[model samples]
Target: MTTDADDVRSFDQRGGAAQPKALSAIRTIARREIAEQLSSARFLIIALLVVGLTPLAVYVGARDYKSRLEDYNRLVAEQQKMIAGPAGREVKGFDVGWSEGNDLAVLRAIRPPEPVSALVRGLDGALPQYWDFSPTGIVTGPLASRPQRIADVVGHLDMAFLMRVALGLLAILLAFDAVAGEKELGTLRAVLSQPISRAALLTGKLAGGAVTLLLPLAAAFLIALISAQLFGVDLIAAGALAKVVMLALTAGAYLVCFYALGLFVSSLVSSQKTSLVVLLVVWVVAVLAVPPIATMVAQAASPVPTSQYLETRKDALDLDIRRQAELEMGGVYREITGDPEGNADTDKYYKNKESIDRRIVPIEVGYLNRRRQILNEIDRDAERRAANQNRFASLLMAISPAAAFAGAATDLAGTGDAQYAAWLESVRRYQDSLNAALFDDPPTVMIRNRGASFPAELRKPPTVADLPSFAPPRRDAAAVLSRSLPAIGLLGLFTGVFIIGGFFAFSRYDVR
Candidate 1:
């Protein structure tokens, strides 16, 4: 009366002779599972859902990317034209004078849509598209002409979304009945009557079900890539293709994790219906609920100031600094003109204009520099807080395989938060260059008859060609892979944990 465990031990002891038999048993079981899945109505329906929705999602995403690209080009052209000043006319360049009324020279750094956004939208639309630079600091806002619609708020359907929601659900459906349903049908008892080990049986089921789930996904993914390329996305580029491959691998791991989880649940439960119910609840929680709930929790835990609050604080600081400068300049004016009220004779003011500017320019420059320092501090503080909040949210969301896969997919596509941060860093570098070109040379300020004026030489602004232009930073495949590796590793860990759990639970599962 040898138990199944004794049989497994004996089979292992048989060594070389038993190895081929075990492999053949696993292969046979896998083939049987694959045949059963392919003929099932539920599998066909889900496969059809994925195959049909993939093209539609890609088409919609491509069209949206085209619109954003068009808007980006138009804004960039306008920015260049403005920087060049009015054509065919003699234009006064920036008035680099210490006058509160004079506007600072402003430049715009616009971010173009990532080409791979057609497959994975990530933060492309939500992130700031353009940043306006001034001597004061950077100001960020969306294009006023293109307001965010409901669709943008809800999010666009892309390959990542389809993988997380549709394919993930499909994976669960494929494996939810893998073990328990066989037990209920009395097929498990018949299969276990053979010399096949439980480990081999589970492996066969996992491999076959994975194939059944992944075939439609792989086909649909290829079709989506082709559709994106046809719509003018440059997926054929070496770097882009590599990222696409990484994205595909991420999607596969994500789906397999769900399948493994289903298999684990099926083994743990005695009834197929109970296993499915439990798996569906887990899917809803992991896929539909976790990421957003984690974000909200992180936000509440690590509170950060809003952009509007930061902007208001900066504006108040600017006004206070400006008022302080005005008071200091008033005293200088009173001293120069020998008037308590600070009213100066037009003739005397002009006569002493050079001396007045020599005295007052330094005072104005000091205040301006002080304001820049304080505003920069505010911006840096806000950025730090935001980064902390984001990092915490990411850690919490990584608990879900769906979120992990999405993070990896978006990073590979160059449409994730990391890429957006890189764009912002480039904008900051441009701001620094602009500051060096313009603000580093302190302009003299002359107060005459209650008006501030600059020297004739200062009226001619720096050459447009000499000014720095915004060039978006590009991340190579290596950098993207580095960013995506953590998420990929997490997905792999999830798959391994669930598969191990399934193996352990199925070993003790009652087949009688």
Candidate 2:
């Protein structure tokens, strides 16, 4: 009994000789907290839920994208058939009544490029270098084509919906209880009583909590990769992988900021219940309230209507084309002959007038072109201003945890407003192409006024190969990285401030 007593005394002496360092104490506290969290049933449930639901969401999104892609292909084929019929041989709605010599001359004037379908499909950035001719020898435009429809669908859901809603919600769930829950349990007093500095304790806790949260995030990344492969997505380069990693890091930063906010709330409130209530309220405002409100404000301020409105306007404009054609022919004839008044020499004047009208065909084409430009400009400006509103809202909400998640998640998913901006850019490029094709060399029209032989002047129709092709815009990785820096920096600063403040608050805390 005496020997055992002596051994206990010796061990106590050794322990006293080497007192726990401040960092060591803080680390021990953090370790204990981490262990406590892992042992709790809540952590297990969250992990299970994330792992289980992620696959289902990815699978559904991929399947839908694939379905749309197939439908678009069929639509393109049907459009090609419609464009290839008798209408294909007509030049701007003018029927060809060519004499044998004129027919041969018209056929030679415009021959289809070899393999014209490739250019029409939008696979090539411009018209194909070659085309193929039909047996009838009628020149036709490239087959109606567009990028695989699946590309748009996958781009929408993969980058936007998944990143914004999924990872963001997960980050919030992980962080909400981080500091506040500690105050709920009675052990917070014991933790603060240690000799360690408040800063060291806060740092240790943050590091430990991060490790716990990141494990599942890593799993989510693996799932995303698998989903991408399963859906036959061209897993080119490491772009997708990098995006996923960046998204996870952004989510982690958002949660870290929230964790610090929760700690601050906990420090101010004596009770955990009040801290939780405050945290939830903040979530509601930031996540649920702010985004939609921002969208509404943007729409009201910029006045960009839905796609339905644009479609209706387009239909109306199409209906007035015949009237526009008449105006164009009349205006061109007046401009060319320099005669505003009617002439009495019907036979001679009419024959000469047809040639003059043909020369000024470009004027009519220009009028049609300008009208389209005005509508496009309106749509573009409205969308640009609305996007600016959304960006402003994101910056303002960086102060709140909920807003942080929304911004960060969207950045990660690559589906945020930036995606629409890319589409706009593509449309602009397409417009430039249209200008090059049509306006650069406007067509001349020879009117046949008398019921007789073909008009003395001949005109050729524009070829489909001459039409512009659309190229979709892709985001610059560097640009996205730069945009994200502000959010990350602000969150980091907020987290540091809360951690330091919480440490000091706990240091002065009374432990009776």
Candidate 3:
């Protein structure tokens, strides 16, 4: 009994879903967003500059990597020559042929490895290269040396300059016109009057804006890759490529976060100009003004003294000579194989030896222990101060998207302060290994003039080549990733909140 008109009416009612229906509509909006920026002369100029300079920077970084590799090779050759030369004479008079008067025992106790092991691509290296002198982290033992200069260059081009500056700028530019510009053009009320839901309208705009902002980053990454390859740096490792992809994604997340932040401020404020000013101020305080100040504060709170000062302090407190008398008595007993009273006849020589041993052993142990203690104290103080800085930096990350981006990007690059501190820990472990090698025996050898009939070979300590090189404790990349999760969580959380807020705010906005 239903009429044709009723059937048509029911279909029409079903079609009223409170959203944009066609894929074409979303594409149209996204296209508009990108086109708007492409038409801007200022943005065009900036994009061009970023494109042109990225390649140049990569080339310079590659050249620097090459130079360092050459230097490491030269250092290795020099070390080999030194080991074979006349200067590498052995010491005598000690239990192990080491002389007591010479610190050659200490020198031979911790022989440095050939510098070639530290270089990337030295005389044609391979992948998974480990960098030397990385205060953040370094691989220990013999490993492949691939030039990480590509990582550095790509990181610099894509993350530091782009996310912190370029994309941030673009976000501000897009947001400046988000609401006010529409109102100024007298089309705000017209757009709001449509039957479309407010949230849908806002979602469309934000989607559009994000597309515009992220395109440049994508372009930059592509161009940077091509340019790096030209400079003899191949960052084509799976990990490296994965890292780059994550960086781009991170950049996009940052763009949306900042754009949302700017839009929120813009909506709350009365004028576009004021909103732009506020954003610029926030950017400067969070990105340009904060990290360096934090570093300075940390350094001041926990100072790092020079090695010479530590050495001088150690030398001035010579406990060796002070305990010499007891050592001499002890030595006499050992030589005579009896108590001090039983060796009374030889007490003079025994006492003298005992005194020297007492003076030397205690002073050396004390010096080493005290220095180690002082260094530990300094390091703890530094860590404490860094903790304070980290807290403040975390706060900045919450308030400013630029800070979040910087934190994420640097964390990815393994260039942040935390990573650097971890690297220091590895080096300290290596030093401990060196200490163990030195103290394995009497740990002290005395150098002496050759016996009248002995050859020159009998007068010197063992060759430096005989000693073992220091090896740092190994690090797990997964562990590093786990440690960084909190920062990542913070950034990811911020992005999520902004995304939700952006859609909500845009939907509810009074366009009129």
Candidate 4:
């Protein structure tokens, strides 16, 4: 019984000619395996599934992006109009007049939809697309559009979803019977008796099967890009194109993880049926069960307060501060006018206006400062808790290669939590800028005089250009790649573990 090692050593003794022969053997086996997989009914079915579903997913995602973009544009226009007044000339039809009391009225900042979300809609759909800033506090706006209830159940049809679910299953199907079925048919013994080493045989099978599995995926990717273009999604720009390429590479790595896992299972089992059943169960657990269960566990373990609760608390705080300020101002008014009811005669009121304001303005400024500090504290606490919960969920979900792939894909596509967080930080900066522009100086109470009721400085409306505009932060490719590294590393780790396991298991596999 000459082993493959003995055959290899004998060939090595023949003047180093064995290297080329072994390479030829591996190539031959790879080609044969590829032909077999391409001719199989299962391959055809899976190919059709990829080709048919990818474009549909792209279409749905593109339509959603368009709708959100429209909403974003409309909101931005409204915000600009509200700030600059009608026709940018006069303050006609404006809700808030240019008065001291109404200086810090509601201001808004809108986040535009990411163009790459036409392929992967991650936290983009879930996170608020706008924020409102006011004297009281910042408020998160509602989602640009509500997702269908069915989408909550079935999930969004996007490239990430298809790669995680459909392509993962295809990888499993293609590799589940690679070694076990050959053994069952007694073909493994005949192949092992040939001049090829076991390592070469395994390498050939892996190469051949990967090619078979990835060809359909490539075609599906092409179709998806084409569909995105047809629907007016701009994925061809240099930055977006780079992200798309990264996404494609991430998908390839994810599928390879499943393929290697299936091959390892096939080598470990004695029968093809047993191998397939085992791989199917693993696939279900990894793809369908792990991500949601991780989320549930994370939520249960690290609960955060709801947005409504925080909003209510801030509202209550604002009311308390306002009531306190009013009481103090009333006391000041009585002291200045020597009227217990603070109802001084018009002549007396006009005469003491300056004196009363000097006493009352400090009270108003102090209360305003107190209110902002308390509200900002509450917001920081909420954000910290939410961040902790997200980190925990991400750690748990990393157990599933599918989830890892989704994370990487979404991050690259600029639709992930990282991108959303960046958007939020930008909005906060804009909020701060707006506050400085409107309230840097303490506004003085203006008494109605015989000539003008409003301040002479505010006679003309301020144009939109007068205010600080929001400049959305753009993440360069390097920054996005850095953010995606953790998930990408997890995927690579999964692929390595499965490939090593398959090689080790197949080395001892019995074909008798």
Q: What's the lDDT for all of these models?
A: 0.78, 0.50, 0.52, 0.78
What candidate 1 gets wrong by more than 4 Å, as runs, is 1-19, 79-107, 141-148, 337-352, 429-438, 442-471
Per-residue lDDT value at 226 in model 2:
74
**Model 3 misses residue 379 by how many Å?**
5.2
Task: For candidate 2, write residues 336-364 as lDDT tens digits.
Answer: 55556322135544657556544544444
Q: After superposition, how far is residue 144 of candidate 4 from its true place, in Å?
A: 1.9
Ten residues in sequence with the least summed lDDT for candidate 3: 113-122
Instruction: Give the lowest summed-lDDT range of ten residues in model 1.
Output: 87-96
Per residue, candidate 3 scores C-alpha lDDT tens digits across 142-207 of 323344677533433333565577667777777766666666676667766655555555566678
Candidate 4 per-residue lDDT, tens place, 34-139, comes to 9998998888987898789988889988998999999888877866665565433332112122243343223456778887889998877777878766544466
Q: Tell me the spans in candidate 4 whose CA falls farther than 4 Å from its real position.
A: 1-20, 79-107, 337-352, 432-471
Q: Native-vs-model 3 lDDT?
A: 0.52
- State in Å the error of residue 403, model 2: 3.6
* lDDT (Cα, tens digit) per residue for candidate 1, span 20-75: 47778788888998999999988898889888888888897787788888888887
- Using Cα atoms with residue i matched to residue i, what is each candidate's TM-score against the true structure? 0.85, 0.67, 0.66, 0.85
Candidate 4 TM-score, C-alpha based: 0.85
**C-alpha lDDT of candidate 2 relative to the true structure:** 0.50
Which residue pairs clash in candidate 2? 113-130, 113-131, 113-132, 114-130, 114-131, 115-131, 141-464
